[model samples]
Target: MNQPHHRPDPYTERPWLNPAISPFIQIQGVTKRFGDFTAVNAVDLAIYQGELFALLGGSGCGKTTLLRMLAGFETPTEGRIIIDGLDMTEVPPYERPVNMMFQSYALFPHMNVFNNIAYGLRRDGIKSDELKRRVNDIIDMVELNPLTHRRPHQLSGGQRQRVALARALVKQPKVLLLDEPLAALDKRLREQTQFELMNIQDQLGITFVVVTHDQEEAMTLATRIAVMGAGQFEQVGTPADIYENPQTRFIAGFIGSANLLSGTVQDCQPEKGTDDAPDTSRVQIVTDEGNQLLSVSTDRVVAAGDAVTLAIRPEKISVTLQDSAVSDTADKVPDNAPNTVSNNGSGTVPGYVSGNVPENVLWGTVQEMAYLGRLSTFRIKTDAGPTLEVTAPNQRRVLDNRHLIDWDDRVRLTFSSDSAVLLTR
Candidate 1:
């Protein structure tokens, strides 16, 4: 029996992609300045309901500042913040429909887990019965029932984190703001807790805004990520989108590992399409290494002679030992030999045996290698000046120390044109 394929519902699974739906949180022209420095420039963003959005960047990149503004801790110098169709720019932190869990957890040392979770409801003057009900319900949700009687001092780091999370969630705020929520846990526990946090967010269906400096954390936890740089947003998109199609060199280098090559546009061939469809151009780039590269560009315009950069992910590159038959002929090719386009529109290195090698291929020697359990990373120092990084999966277990490819061995690196990203900036 054949089952029908279930397509994703864009309205529920990805509201941002649907233009008809309104944003749940809108930051309009928001900026924050302190003394002589601008912590956050004029930034605008829209977050839909039930999104687990992440603000990702390094320290001093203004991710925290922007989050504080969202929490009403810092007033925006020049814009407005709207949450659920209400202006919250000037609203007090306590009055806003949001709860923030600090990085330190900030559990009350004198209180037990149950009391800590109930403190918010108590302070709000809820009835004793209702407070107990809410506290117990949240404790069960976070799976802290066994540790309900334990104080912060008696609980483990993960337990205390759950207590703080229950405390914040007991109030049932419309949005939850987490400041490096998993920073305090050990590596193994942090990875474990990431799924827990996501599960809690899913059960509650609350919009969660997380601020973190760790790229892997953001990429793992966020439904969408906003990469910050120098008090402004460098790029904003899904983790896959940000990783696969970074807009600039900064984003290309920041989001993940990228091998960047400076180049000049040699030619541009626009793809034929309907007038209403977006324009796409196949760009030919002559890199500084004298290797010609081809990439598809859809977002930016480029013409002949324009300077550009080609960004390639290490995982996209394949490494193979150079053919023994052409070893001597390959060595005869100059380091700076031009890659001329063959009749089939593929690149061929001058002085090398034609048809034996594919387009966008570079000859190099393995300078370094790292075996990372599931995959191996290689640093290949090309015959040209640059060293390119390539990663390949280890398909089978090796009982001996000998690897399929070893250090100091001559290798050829090749990647498809679609794997290379064209960055104009």
Candidate 2:
């Protein structure tokens, strides 16, 4: 028998995974303090070459402070900063091999787009011909050729952003530090510019370190993300790694919305495995409110009586009417109603009634509903004394409101055993 050849995934080409490859930028035990206030805690980080890394956090989370340190704007109160193979702890801002794009594009009002981009090259004493070639090449790369003569005041928000980017890139720095680069644009333009930024970064291959509070921006743009909280790194990994397997309760709630329920572990069933493979366990949890949930193939270890939290995303849940016979008076439905149901003749959610409820099922009443064109969000008041949010897509056009899953309807919620994450923190 012949072995099959495996094709590599482009997104999974992680240089950081190879231990022999040295880090392009390294921050070892870096910390910053202002009098009694500690802005950044002692944190260690490694950035690979040509990687688009993001420092993500909310207001006052030390992401900006760390970015400034990398740019040589602020010296660390403790620890060292290394770029390539040199220690740059005390290097001045202008002397470092990095360029920073401020949140406010920072284009000169008196200079047109061309002069704004050429300003840095002129200060470096480049000859006129070489300066013009570099500046025009960058301008063309950013698609700002026709607007080169326009001043900052005459350009729209998106065009001004391109000018700022062109100015930053013309100097040909080894690294680019962007402090909330896309924060000023409106929603649609911001989304569009994110792709443009990615394309330019791919073309240049310069290491980029971005600071942003927007989760979606970081997820869409970064090859890896470092989620910070209160002067410390909460977690650092690829977008999918951080989102799917959050290490803490704060991370589980911060990256996205999760229905967090407090519970106690009822038992654990650890499966046998080889030494090289990760150990797997099936955990049974009973909520404080008397609801039972099961998590399958979880990697976390927990014994009976250990307190834990079960996190389930809203989109992972499936909701359907309990029965077609159920009436306006939801309380009339039997407490021990059958866990399975027929279509009830309503076409709202077809094929949803064909299976029995999974181990992670809840009986609830639809308390609220919001139709937002593509999908509808529902807040279900579970009989277990918790309000669970469920989102369902509107697959077919709604011709009549009568057939829709309305408010106060008795509903059953089910999720796959693997969908629920077990968090012991």
Candidate 3:
């Protein structure tokens, strides 16, 4: 049974994110090698039943090798793989209670869609009546009934992918392993197919382990992600956790664009409030540029003079054009302490209308601008010889050809102390 939690997510309303649920798949001390090359190191993982898990990493990062281990294609050099209270360490490819959909969609060119999907069942010596019924059911589920008569060569890339999926689903395996399943399709089809795959998994209630290098796809389709690197998992959590609260420097840079600034914790200020409220503590970090940043961390025992890193995303920082009278060199600004964002009764950043020197504002000149529709990315160079990337949204339309912090404009980039993420590693 699944545990109860209030954090309802879009992908699945079930609280599989709760750690209390018993694991359905466990990989313990698993290692693999090929000709002195360590493809996979000793890694431990736990995946719950009916969960869509993503093994996310770059090429040669051991994601596929791990999936192959789960599929019984690659025998582990040392370790145990348990699934549904059964040990599958010595299981063969065809005898294992799991199915693997290869990256190439490995369909027979001469066989039609129905025959391709029924080939497995036919190989098992099932009669034509049962095989025909199973093929039709999977074809209907995958919405490929119209293309059942078409051969692999006659089908499109997306169609071929669906055919492969239908073939894997026809057997109703306890777990389905997909290796770069959507890599064969174009961008448009891949985006549309991701949700389709998710819906099918939800309906079937089978645990899915997908290996993919595409971070966005992993974020979109996976219930939880395991970020792998150098044959070991760097981090494993929900997509939100991996992106928002990255543990290591590699995770911060690998998941998304993070502005990592070196700093040291100068102080830890605990909030002085009632017991009902969380014991929220704010840590102050002084950057290498001699500027300090404040961050809120709940579960760390931090101290003064401890080196740390302040990681913040690009979208969280706000940039506004400041006139020459109020703006000066970046280092010239007085810094008593790092300042956070404040509400000026209008619920907007201070000094948005008037040219007042607001807190957390830094002087910089726009060096480059990328005009993506609905969003604009600017590369701003500070007077202190550092470049901070800022992304601003176009919420309001301008009819008079007005630009908000245009090219070559001297701007003051502002970010709240709460936006700063403190990473000790």
Candidate 4:
């Protein structure tokens, strides 16, 4: 038998699928409003113990509002909040078993690091040797030992952030709520602090609820992400699940860059194969653009003529020069690949039609090009379909312009059927 891999990043899979633990925090049908406007809708969620959970969304999307409610700064206009098996809806912010770290870091300008950290310890009535030990322990935990005697203004932005973190953690609350905790730091510092924050969360085993609009931050910091839209959660899953298998068009577009093509289903062959590898329903969709055909494997049973959408990420599609004249049949692609499409099919995509129309091939002229350091991104304007954006890594250093896919160059884009997701929405 194979040994299981140690230290899985997101902890194997979604918490719902794991049978070992129950929810440590529960928000059952929670909603909040300011005047007539609803900031948070009726949302049901469960967060397990020691989880680095993130509430992600765009501005005015209710993520910060939800964090405020969780921290007892704002009461839910409807529903209840429970943490560590106790109802916290009406509990005052001071009494709640949670500490909030604001976006500003909110350090005391006059007080030095040690005093700031000790403020909370003193408030909790811990005195003398015990207080000093607790403050020292937390200061060391956040790596702010050297700055213990320095004032907030004397510290760098990152050190101030660490001090704020130390202050929040010194209390050792059951849950920590951070509102855009890393927003103020520079990109490089933010990236470095991401792992540092993750490590502290892991060592302390404290449940962390972070709110961020940055997708990469959420992906890197949290075990689970709840994508909020219009005051409600659209989907909750691990980073892979949210990126690879988004349930809605908004999610596909929001989580990452996606190419969306509208189409209509021509037919579906439901459950047709064998015992060992059961055949999933094969859906053949004709693009509304009138020149494309795509097939995908889906679990849903839908009738012909139903409207559908084909969603694929840029990296999933293969881009190449047109001289190969590769065929686009099912056999052309590897068995492991799905929904194969190509650019060699001259008439198949938008602009031109010819006698030898290759299947799954799209012919387009590069309208724009951007040579990003690690990747080259191209925007193609075709004669028949919508413009497509394709990105390919610069594996080899390009010394000459000839190696690059220049503007207005006729290039071919190919992709597997299974690589594209069929969405009814």
C-alpha local distance difference test of each model: 0.85, 0.84, 0.81, 0.82
Which window of ten consecutive residues has the lowest lDDT sum in model 2? 345-354
User: TM-scores of the models, in the given order?
Assistant: 0.90, 0.89, 0.86, 0.88
Tens-digit per-residue lDDT, 182-237, candidate 1: 98899999999999999999999999999998899999999999999999999999
> What is residue 372's positional error in candidate 4, in angstroms?
0.5
Clashes of 4: 18
Candidate 3 lDDT by residue in tens digits, 5-39: 65545334444555556678999999999989999
Order of quality (lDDT): 1, 2, 4, 3
Each candidate's number of clashing pairs is: 0, 0, 0, 18
Instruction: In model 4, state the lDDT of residue 392.
Output: 93
- Clash total of candidate 2: 0
Candidate 3 regions with alpha-carbon error over 4 angstroms: 1-20, 272-280, 290-298, 323-359, 398-402
Cα lDDT tens digits for candidate 2, 295-410: 53489988989999988888889887877434532333365643232236232321122234355556889999988878889999987677899989988777766536779988
lDDT of 2 at 144: 91
Report the lDDT tens digits of candidate 4 across residue range 333-391.
Answer: 32233222344733343211223333245656788989888999888765456688889
205: Cα error in model 1, Å: 0.3
